[model samples]
Target chain A: MDIRKQFGANVRKHRQATGLSQEQFALQHDIDRTYVSGIERGKRNPTIVIVNKFAKALDVSIADLFDGCD
Target chain B: MDIRKQFGANVRKHRQATGLSQEQFALQHDIDRTYVSGIERGKRNPTIVIVNKFAKALDVSIADLFDGCD
Candidate 1:
């Protein structure tokens, strides 16, 4: 899969694992809901800062988000 | 260190391992030399696409770029 898609999938997986809907996740993380949606749909290309935010919110390493993406 | 700085250090490490100067590596990878320099200095916040490009150029996984970053 494309890295963006893979990242989106990973984000979705981790978010779901936390039992938070996209909106809830965004609210809790201080990220825009629409932006989160875009990211989850692979329609957005977030910078490393934003990626780090997601990793922090998800309690995962940056590497974990790209796991199995190769 | 910050993730961006760590990423820059990792990029520099990999690029040096390949025995290529920033200009030479940029020319070979079709990336802007100044952009590479910016990335290496952690002054640029690259999106995942650019990160993927670096990973591909370095023949490493996205995870590798982030190794020891956390």
Candidate 2:
């Protein structure tokens, strides 16, 4: 699988685990809802800074977001 | 220090530990050296795909790149 897609899947898993809708997640994290949607769909390439935002918003470590993808 | 700066410092630390110059590292990873420099300097926001490239190139995990940076 493409790494980006794997990453996106991981993100989706964790995001869903948090029980927030995509729009709610983005608004709570101060990220654009469309950007969040794009990332969840693996159509967007989110930067490390943005990755940090996701991690922070999700309350997970960067590694945690990537767990078991390999 | 800002988290981004901390992230940059961590990248520099791991990159240097590989004993490759920034240019060499970037070339080996197919990343632009200028982009690597910007990332190391906390001046660029690299996507998770790029971050994965850096982690793969540096022989580290995404978590490892962010160790002790909280």
**Which number leads on DockQ?**
1
lDDT of 2 by residue, A1-70 (tens): 6666777888899999999999888888788888888887888887777777787888888777667544
Q: Model 2, residue B23: displacement in angstroms?
A: 3.0
TM-score of chain A of each: 0.94, 0.87
Report the lDDT tens digits of candidate 1 across residue range B1-70.
8889989989999999999999999999999999999999988889998999999999988888888876
Backbone clashes for every candidate come to 0, 3
Residues B4-37, model 2: lDDT tens digits:
7777888999999999999998888888899889
Clashing pairs in 2: A47-B46, A47-B47, A48-B46
Lowest lDDT 10-mer window, candidate 1 chain B? B61-70
TM-score of 2: 0.83
Q: Write the per-residue lDDT of candidate 1 for residues A39-65, one digit (tens) a residue.
A: 888888989888999999999988888
Candidate 1: residue A68 lDDT (0-100): 75
Clashes of 1: 0
Provide DockQ values for all models, in the order shown.
0.84, 0.58
